[model samples]
Target: MILERIIPTVLSVRRILRADPALVKAYGGDPEKHTSLGLVTCDQDDAMYVALDEATKHAQVDVIFARSFYAGAAHASGRLSGEILGVIGATEPEAIENGLDALLRCLEHDACFYDADGKRTVTVFPHVIASLGEYLSKEAGLAPGTPMAYLVAPPIEATIGLDAALKAAEVRAVRVQPPPTETNFACAWLTGDLDACEAAAVAYAAAVVDVAAQPRR
Candidate 1:
C-alpha cells in the first residue's frame, strides 16, 4: 500500500516512441535477435515491487518504468485500493519470459504479458495511437525539407519554452518532452527552415530559463 501511494516515475520512453516509431519497433522485434518489452500487473503493490526486484536479480532485464496505486473515484467509493503496473525490458525474448516467470510464478493469478516472437500480449502504455485524423491534423506542408533544432532544459520549464518556441517561428514538426531523460531533464524540437529553427530554438531556451527561474506565485 505504501508503494502504491507514491507517485509513478515519468514515462520517458514515450518521447522515444513518438519520435521514431520504426526505430523502437525494430528494437522490440524478434525476441531471438532483439530485445523485448514486458508488462506485469499485480493486486498487491508491495508484492509486485519485491517480485520485480527478485526477477531483476535473477534475470538480465531492465525496468523501463513502473507505477503503483493510481487513485481514482473508484478508490474513493471503497470499491478498490490500488494496483501495481510495471514495464520490463530485456535483450532476449527468453530473458523476458524467464524474468517474468521468476517474479510471478509464486502468485496465483499473475497477469503478465510480453512482446516477442510475433506475439504482442501487452500494450506499452505510451505507444498507443487511437485516432487517424489527429495524426493528419498536423500540416507538414508548413515547412518541407527543413532541418530541426533542439533545445534542452529542465522539465519544470516545458510549458514556458514550448509556448515561446511555437510562437517565435513557423515550424513543421515539434516534439516536447517534459521529462525526456533519466535525469528528469526536458527538451523540445523545432523543425523548419534553418533560420526559423534557429530562431525558435533561441526563444525556447530563453523562455525555459526565464520561466523556471522565477519564484512561485
Candidate 2:
C-alpha cells in the first residue's frame, strides 16, 4: 500500500441484520444472499468507491448503494453525514463485518487524494487497480480481474489528465464523467492490462501536476 496519501476518514459505521423490508428492497439487497447491511460514510466521496471495491474482495458482499452529497463534507447534511454514504449487503452479519473491515482498512491506508505539490492546494487522485474486484467490475461494466485506471480530479484537470493518460498507454475508456459532479469534480475509468493501466495512471498524475504547475499559457 502507498504510504503517502490524504486519507478519507470514515465518519460513521452501521450494520443492520434483518433490515426493514422496504429499506432492503430500496438498497437492492437480495433477501437470501443479502440479509445484512453494512453502511458507512466517508469525508471524500471518490475515496468511498475504492473502499467499497476493496470490501467486495474481502467478503461475500455486494455494494448495494453509494452516493455523494452535493458540495462536499463541508456542506454535509449532518455532522456524521460526510460527503458520501455507501452500503454493502451480505448473507449474514459476519460477512458484513469482514466487508466493513476492508472498507475501514482501505480508508485508513489507501485510496486517497495526493497533493500535487508540497506548497500548492492542487489535488488529484489517479489510481490503478491491478485486479478489479467484483463490485467495481460490475459498476464499470467490466470483467473481474481486469485492470482499471480510476482517475478523478477537479473538472478541468481530470479532463486534461485523462487525455494524457490515453495517449501514454494502450487503454480503453470504459467510462467518462464530465464536470458538475456532486463534489464538482470529473472522472474517467480506463481498462487495460495491469502495466498499461499503471502507465495510464502515472500519465494522468503527471498531466494533473503539469496543470497545477502552469495554470495558463
Compare the candidates by lDDT and give the number of the best one.
Answer: 2
Candidate lDDT scores, in order, read 0.45, 0.87
Evaluated against the true structure, the overall lDDT of model 1 is 0.45
Per-residue alpha-carbon lDDT of candidate 2 for residues 1-217, written as tens digits (9 for 90 to 100): 2214777878999989888878888877776667899999988888899889999999989998999999988789999999999999988899999999998988888788877755536678898888889989988999888889999888878888999999999999999999978988898999988999999999999888888788785
Give the alpha carbon lDDT tens digit for every residue of 85-121 in model 1. 5555666767777777766653333212112112221
Top-TM-score structure, candidate number: 2
Clashing pairs in 1: none
Q: Which stretches of candidate 2 lie over 4 Å from their true place?
A: 1-4
Give candidate 1's TM-score: 0.33
